[model samples]
Target: MSGLRVIPTRRRGQDLLYVCGTDGRNVAWYDREAARVHLFSEDLRQDVLDALGPFLAGAVTVGPPPVPTAAELVRLALHPDDDLAPNRPGEALLIALDRDPGPAHRLRTDPRRRELAAEQTVGEALDGLEGGGWRTLHSIPLPGGDRVHHLVIGPGGLFAMYALAARRQRVVVTDPLVTTGRREPWPLLRRVRSDAARASYALTAEVRPALVLVEPARLDVTGPPREVRVLTPADVPALARLGGVLKPADVEALYAVARDRRTWGKG
Candidate 1:
C-alpha cells in the first residue's frame, strides 16, 4: 500500500495508482491491487508522480470530470491537462521516456529537453505573431503517426519546422541535411517534405518546411535544400516577423484543423 497509493492524476475524478515494482516506478490502473500500466508519455508520468507525491498528501480526491461528461473517461484515459483538456502528444513522449527509456528515449529527459526548450523559446519569440497576421501550432501530428514540431502560417504561406537542441555542439548543415560531429547526419529535409505535404492538406495551403538546428554556439549551412531553410534558433524571430497575411477564412480553417485535439493523438 505504501508504494501503490490511490491518487488523482492531474485531472480530478480520474484516479490512477503510484506504483513501485521490481522492474521500476510507474503509474498504472489498479483493480484489487492489480496493476495495468498504461504506456503513454513517460516524462509526463514522472512529472505527475513527482508532483503528485506532495499534492496528493493534502489535495481533494475528486471533483468529477469536466462537462460533456460522456467524454470524461476517454479524456482521462488519453491523458489531459490539469483542467481536463488534452495535452500535446509530444508531452507524453517526454513522460514515456522517463518510464521505459531506450537509447533514443533515454536522451529525452536531458538533451531532448534542450530541443524542446528551444521550441519553447521560439514560442516566446513568436508571442506577437498571433491575431490575424500569423498563427503557429506546436507538436502537430501527421496521419502517418509522425509529429511535426512547429507549424506556422501567414500571408507568405505555411511553414513547418523540425527543431533539435544541440546546445553549442558542433553541427554541419549540408544543404538538404545535417551531420553533427558527434552524431550522424539527420535527414530532416525528408521529414520537411512529408510534413509540408501533410500541412498543405491540413491547411489547404502549400507549406514550405524548415529544419531548425538549434545550438547555443555556432551554426552554418551550405547549399541546403531549396525548399527547406536551415537556420538557428536565434533566426526564428526575424522569420516570424515576415508579416505574411492570410485571409480570415484561411486563418480560421488552418487554426481549427491544427488545434483539434483529435489530431494530437493519445499521449
Candidate 2:
C-alpha cells in the first residue's frame, strides 16, 4: 500500500487534490485547472499518482509545479497580518464593535449596524463578480483614520466605492450633497471622489469613484454627479461586462498590490 491519501482543498476558487503521506505531509497535489499533478518529491511520484488515481480525470502532466507568477510570488511573500485580501465587508467596523459593543440593550439601533449591512450587501455583490475575473478588497484603511469601503479591480478597471445605508429611505443627490430621507444633506459625493483620488495616487492608476446605495426606496438626481457613478447593489454585476481596460494578468497584478495593507498607507 502507498499509505497515501488524497485530500481535497479549494484555493482562489480552484479545486486541488493533495496527496499526503501517512505522516500527513503533502507529497503532491492535483490541480484540475492546470490539468497537472505536481510532485514535491520525484521519489514519491508513482506513489502520489497511485494515491490520486481515482480522482485523476483525462490526461494530466506529471511533474513539479509550474513556476509561480509574479502575482503569486507577491502574495506568497506577504505576511498574514499585512494581507488585507481576507478582510470581511465591514472589517474595521466589526473590529470596532467587537472592542466596544456598548450597551447590550440599546434604546435605539446602532447606526454602525446599518452601515455594516450596507457594506456586506454591496461586498457580497462585488464578490460574486470574481468568476468574471474581478477582485475586491473591503475596508481598505487610508491614512488619518479614514478608509475606502471597498476597492474593485477587473477588466472594467479600478473603482473605489463607498457604501451608504439608505435602507427604505428616499435618496436625493444634488451635486456634492446627498440627502437620505429627511436627514440633512451631506457632501458624501465629495468624500467618495476624494477617496478614489487618494487610491489612484497610491496605486498610480486611475480609479473611478462610486457610491452604492443599499435598498433605497427612491432615488432622485438633479443631474449626474461629475466623476462619480452612483449605483445600487443590482448595478454591480453589470460592471463585469466591461473589458478592454485591463487584461487578466493586469487585474491580478493590481489586486496583488491593492491587497497589501502597506499599499494604502501611502494614501
Candidate 3:
C-alpha cells in the first residue's frame, strides 16, 4: 500500500486499541476492534466507525507468545548473525540485541502463518525449505495455530545462496525470503538492540534494520518497541516467485544444506 503503520495491541472491555498512521495521517486510538484496521480511510471517519462493527467483539493480542524466560527472547532476537551461529537455545538468548545488524520483525496472528508455524512444535515451519532455494529452518508457535519460521540467506539477494523450510518439513526452497526480500504485504517487525556492555558479553547482537521491500506504515501502540503490519495471504505469490528463482549461489548453498537430512538435525 501507500504507507503503513503498526501498533502493539491488546483488548480492553470488548474493543481494540492500537496506534495507526498512514503516509499523510496518523493517530492512536481505542476504537472498535474492526476499526483498528478495516474502518478507516484517508478521508472522513464516517465509514471508518461503521466498518468496525464486525471486529468490535474481542481484543487483539499483542506480540508473539511469551517465551519462558526474558533470556530466551534475547536469544531468539539475537540469533542468525553473520559473525555468530545460534548454537544452543538456552545460551542463545543471552546475546544482546545490538550485536546483529540484520532487521528483525515478529510475525502477527493470521491462521495461515500460524498453521505454518505450529505452536510449540519442533518442525512447524518446515514448509519453506522443501522447494529449491532458501527454506525454513525453525518455527515459533503462537496462541492460535499459527507459527513464525526463521530463514537465512548468505551471499546476496540476486546473486546469493540461501535456505528456507517449514519447522517440520525438510528445509527446502518452497519458502524463500532468505535472499530476495520479495514477500509482499509482509509485516513490519520492530528491531531490538542492546547497549555496548551487554553486546560485548553476549557475543550475539542485532539492530532493527528495515527489510529490502517491507516498510513500516504506522504504529500500533505507544511504547519503546512497537508493532507494525499484520500480514495476509495476498502477499504469498510474490514471495513464492521471488524465492523460487535459482540465480544466487547462496540460494544453491541453502538448498544443498536443506536437502541433506544430516544437516537439519532432528528437525
Candidate 4:
C-alpha cells in the first residue's frame, strides 16, 4: 500500500481588507485600520462587489444615511452584514458613494483630505527607500525634491504601453523612474504583440503598486509587459517645488496605470 501523504496548505480569509473607491478605476487594499477610507467609484463598485462578494460579509456603505441612534449605529457598524444572512457571493449589498447626489465639491472634501495625507506619507516613505538605494518606479508623479526621477516600471515589454497611454491619454507622468532590472524574461510579453494589451494585462493583476515602485530590485516581472522603458529621470527641483498640489484627476491617472498593468479578463 502507498504511504499516506500530507500536504501543507493555507486558506484565504480576511488577511487583507479590500476597499474599492467611488472612482470606477480605483481599488485599494488595507491591512490595518489606518486613518483613511478606501475610495472607489460606483462603476468600479459593481465590479468589485461581483468579484469579492464571495468573501465580504457586511453592509459596505458608500454614503451617510439617516441619523440613527448611537446604539443602532454601533450595531450596524459591527454587524453590517446581518441584514443579508449569509452575505456571500451573489448576495453583496453595495452603495454608491455618489448615490446622495450631492455637490461634487462636497463629495471630494472628505476623501480628498484623507488621500492627501496618505499620499504625503507615501511620498515620504518612498523618499526614504530611494535614499537607501531603493528604486521607485511608478506611472504617477512622486512629490520629492527637484529632479523628479520617477521610474514607470512596466511588467517587462509594456514600456511602449505606458508611453502610448501617457501620450494619447494626455496622462502626465512628469518624470521617469527606472524599471527594476529583471534577470528572467516574462513569457506573456514575448507572446503579446501590442503594448495596449500588455498594459491591460498588468492593471488587473498587480496588487502592490507602491511596493513595485519602491522595490523593483526584488520583483521578477515574469507575468507580462516584458519590455521595460527608462523614462527621462531628470528635473527634480521643479516637481519638488510644486509640493502637495495633487489633483483628483492625477490620482485617477495613477490608478489608470495601475489598472492597465493589473487587468485580467474583460468586465
- On lDDT, the candidate that comes out on top is 2
Point out where model 1 deviates above 4 Å: 1-92, 97-109, 261-267
Lowest summed lDDT over 10 consecutive residues: which window, candidate 2? Answer: 65-74
**Tens-place lDDT digits, model 2, residues 43-155:** 88788878788888889899854544866655556888989999999999999999988898999889999999999999999999999999999999999999999999999
- Alpha carbon lDDT of each predicted model: 0.54, 0.86, 0.28, 0.28
In terms of TM-score, the best-performing candidate is 2
Q: Report the lDDT tens digits of candidate 4 across residue range 1-267.
A: 112121222213324444433322225332222222233233444454455445445555442112334564343332332222222111111122234433657634554333233333334433443232232333221123111112222221112212111111111221222232322323222212233322322332222211112212232332333233222212221223322322333333333333221122221
Could you estimate the TM-score for every candidate? 0.56, 0.73, 0.23, 0.22
Question: Once superposed on the true structure, which residue ranges of model 3 sit more than 4 Å away at CA?
Answer: 1-129, 139-149, 152-188, 192-230, 243-248, 254-267
The positional error of residue 224 in candidate 1, measured at the CA in angstroms, is 3.9
TM-score of 2: 0.73
TM-score ranking from best candidate downward: 2, 1, 3, 4
Per-residue lDDT of candidate 3, residues 1-267 (tens digit): 323343444432444443343521223233443333422223424333333334455654222112234453343342233212322211221222235423446454433332322221222222332353434333222223322232333222221101121222221111211222333422223211111111111111111111122222321222322222122222322344444333454344433333232322222
Cα error, residue 54 of model 2, in Å, equals 67
